[model samples]
Target: MTFTRFVLSKRETTLTVVAGLLTLLGLAVVYSFPTWGGLGGMALFAAAIAVGGFPVARHAFRELWLSRSLGINTLMVVAVVGAAIIGEWAEAAIVVVLFSLGEALEEYSAERVHGALEGLLDLAPPVALEILPTGESRETPVERLAVGDRVLVRPGDRVSVDGVVRAGQSAVDQAPITGESIPVEKKPGDEVFAGTINTSGALEVEVTRLAADNTLSRMVVLVQEAQLRQAPVQRFIDRFARVYTPAVTGAAALVAVVPPLLFGQPFWGEQGWLMRALQMLVIACPCALVISTPVSLVSAMTNAASRGVLIKGGRYLEALSRVRAFAFDKTGTLTEGRPVVTDVVDVCTCGECPEDCGLQHAASVEAQSSHPLARALLAEAEARGIAVPGAQDVTLLSGRGIKGTVNGANVTIASHAHFDEYVPHEPSVCRQADELAAQGKTVILVQHDDEVCALFGVADTPRASSRQALAALRARGIHTVMLTGDSPTVAEEIGRHVGIDEVRARLLPEEKVSAVAALAEEYQIVAMVGDGVNDAPALAQADVGIAMGGAGSAQAMETADVVLMSDDLAQLPFIVQLSRQARRTVTVNIAFALGAKVVVFALVAAGLATLWMAIVADVGATLAVIVNGMRLRR
Candidate 1:
């Protein structure tokens, strides 16, 4: 480490130790006044004041000169000097020692909160085994590795860059990047992130992102930026401290001068007005009150980040706790974005059709399309060992479906709504489509010329954890709503399966924004959850915006106020509980800090508190609030 860093690392400990030793030596000399003589003891007291008071004095001078403000350090220095002027050398030295120790403890507690980011920084390894073009591997620094460079990862080694698996297979532990407890199975085509551990088998990964641009690096930078952003309550306390500190200084001045000069009050005695004024200054420094909210917020944000939840700032963390309504986008937020073919029914009116004839026709027509539902149909056909011939003269029918020529027959596949509006279908087929839609499946009709042949039921089902997540939210009395562009029947069925309280379907992007605005008006604090691209407008409209599966998408990470690194709805309730607990911690810390100061001020006014007792109260309260804020790290 550099000399500057070394000194900074040890500065607080050095200050605390130096002040403590001086305090003990000064007290010993004062107690042995008869043995050392008055001159020697006074000289020792002067040395103690110079040594123990310099740090506090310098800070006070800098703040006064630069900011033109009287801060907590100013209060401490004034109180210490006043005690020294009153010839209370022992009290002055002890006050300086106790105050230094309190500052040291507060600094240490703040460092512990920041240590979470340091832990994240340590996760990515600096080196990787780069595979050259000749198929031989050589150890190289991660910074030298470029995009498309292949790296060989051994079992039990950390993946050095975010990449896709090009060869071999393994079960990679993604806890560092995604907070997932179970190791994920990685194959040749699967994407793996940097900082994940290759747990089981050796693999070769093709790098997609450079070392500096990796997911772990981005997370660390964003977390550092997040800690710098203050919450609403923290800003309020800071402003309050600006006014409160100067007011206390003026009050201390009044207590020192008014009673002694205007009335018959002692100026230099043990219970004199000046002594009471020094005690007031020591007790009402505002150190604890000023620090209470920010420390709690930083600790909470770091804790959330470590668990795969990137809360962008203290403002969002505080807002998340107050969210009364949660608006979720349907496609990629609540359900698996990939639809699967569930049921394939043969509805051929002509008896000449063979078994599985409807699926073959639908798959052949959909094979040319890249849409999710088309993929589902193709996958079903492939799984059944059915062959699909390439279609000719294929054309997309706008938003409805696709039409093509297959096996000398004109094959057309359209959505259920489009089929009802434009195609001539039998009542039995309509009833079958309605029954399938009621089960949360999207229905697509397979028509050959004027005759309907098949009905394919495709559905993007809810995630396994969706029902539990919604139930957890409901248990917390948070209303859940689903806003989607899907048809009303399918959206409501999916909503019912997931226990949503309200379902708003057939919503355009702008309509989703309006729904979010309405929810914000009624609920006061609404959170919009989505894939973060299509729902960006609504997400920005709500009080807090949460994006799902941020680990894969840079857009999601940049767009939302909070990003869940993994596609786990369970993390939603976890972050909610964490945010609420953090808010409660902030409240308790503020209350305790202020209450302690108030009680100490009362005791000082009654002349029952001395300089040592007042400094102890002030230092004790500051340490108490720091420790309380640090509890969120657990």
Candidate 2:
């Protein structure tokens, strides 16, 4: 019963169980028959070979045939034949066993790379807490839940759909999806995504999207979609192994046969030349070299998942290490997109009451126009609760500013360049205006009763982390550059704030692409990071495009090789480090594989290595390379 239980286990355990069973059976048979020595010997040999040779044969066959082409397996076959011709069947069998064992190890290592991403399929609940008409509660299948359904999400539960708070407030931990460690605070009308953990406080949420379109489904789809993409071209060694294996095997066959026949040498001797040829065949097995890369790749992936860096594949991993220059957009990449009013400037003084004059003139004139600057001024006035008097016969001068009459006072508030023609008297106001403009602040001049009053300064400020991240990147020897659509003054101001070394301003979309290409010539490799539609062209051209995936457009993410799961700039340095580590690992695995083969080749010619030893060497070499590559996961 114990023996039966052992035999019913998985493949990894079968070898031990079968070996024990064969040993016991052989012993029993030998005791029963006096001539059982020969029979027992054969049984022992078959059991040992089964425990050894079968695996190698299976692996070599799969690697040779299952592969897109037959290169490596053909070599192993030739080696086996040479051993058999020299009466080294046991040695040949051992070689096959070692080769197969190495192949299995490689497969297992490759499996580690994609071990994360538990399909959120099961996270979808069968029933939802739906608040129906008349405020009655109903437990309906999540499938029945549609847009606008108010789902009552309890504390410590995942939100069932992407929705806004129709009633209550709660906190949601979005780490599972966004890789953000902090739990986001939510309030009414705030859109909470599905699959995010509802941390504290129970809340009612109105679903704005169906279950299919929810974040959970989208994440699963994205991961799956990413998988369907092809990996970068296989590493060079693996490709070489394809042609190398078959050619080596064919040569070994010719060595074993042609030499014995032409030279009239006996098939088997104390030192069988055929045996030497077989050993030579065994020495050429590239299993270790081939398995080395995939194993490392898989292990690296598995480790990275634990840390929330869902690198799509090994190719992207390689590309990340090679990025030399990083291109960034200003509005969101380096600064908070939320702009606020900072200062006001006026070139012309509205005698005695400068404040009211500029406010009255600029607000009235800007109210007539429909530009962002105009809106900023209007919003500022509204926020201050200033009762803006009616402006009469407001005329918007195209490409300039605006003019009108506010409370019987002639008001003309325009861009500083345009206002120069109308308001001219105050040198202090002009200096203040120039200072603000130079710092990248948008300054709007105001003039009432033909006197300049004030200039409103508006600008998007840099985030606290942006400066720190820039410094850290610079410390790591990476050049930090800013690409902006703003004027040179504005670009310089923002560049100084963030400690960026280079700034490219006033670039059109096509120009940005050309700039990146030109820079690529001097730089080792470049990574383009941007959030807007204007950045699409350059992002596609980068060696490794790091898109701000959360705020990023679909086109940007699709074009980029590596997408920052969150807009965390700190992850930039971390990714670059990861790439460096992965590249080193790849090199190490390659070296290990090749080094093992070289040693085996020497041993074979020296006649110190047997077929069995060759098998062990091949399996050991393959296993070592795979394990080495997996170290990148660390």
The candidate that achieves the highest lDDT relative to the unseen native structure? 1
CA RMSD, predictions in order = 3.3, 5.5
Candidate with best TM-score: 1
Could you tell me how far off, in angstroms, the CA of residue 617 lies in candidate 1 after the best superposition?
1.2
Estimate, for each residue in 1-634, the C-alpha lDDT of model 1 and write its tens digit: 3323433578555755766776676666667776764556566666766776788888899989999999988999988888888888778878888887777677777767766687887788899999999999999999999999999999999998999999998999998888899999999999999899999999999999988989988888888888778889988998998998899899989999999899979988679999999999888888888889888888888888888889989999999999999999999889998899988989997998888888898888888889988999999999999988888888899979998988989988998889865568999999999999888788999988778999989999899889999999999989999999998888988998888999999999999999999998899999999998888999999999999988888899999999999999999999899999999999999999989988988997888998999889988999888888888877
For candidate 1, the per-residue lDDT at 483 reads 96
When summed lDDT is taken over every stretch of 10 residues in candidate 2, the lowest stretch is 1-10
List where candidate 1 sits over 4 angstroms from the true fold. Answer: 1-8, 28-45, 346-365, 381-427, 445-454
What lDDT does the true structure give each of the candidates?
A: 0.87, 0.68
As a whole number from 0 to 100, the lDDT of residue 367 in candidate 1 is 86
Backbone clash count, each prediction separately: 0, 10
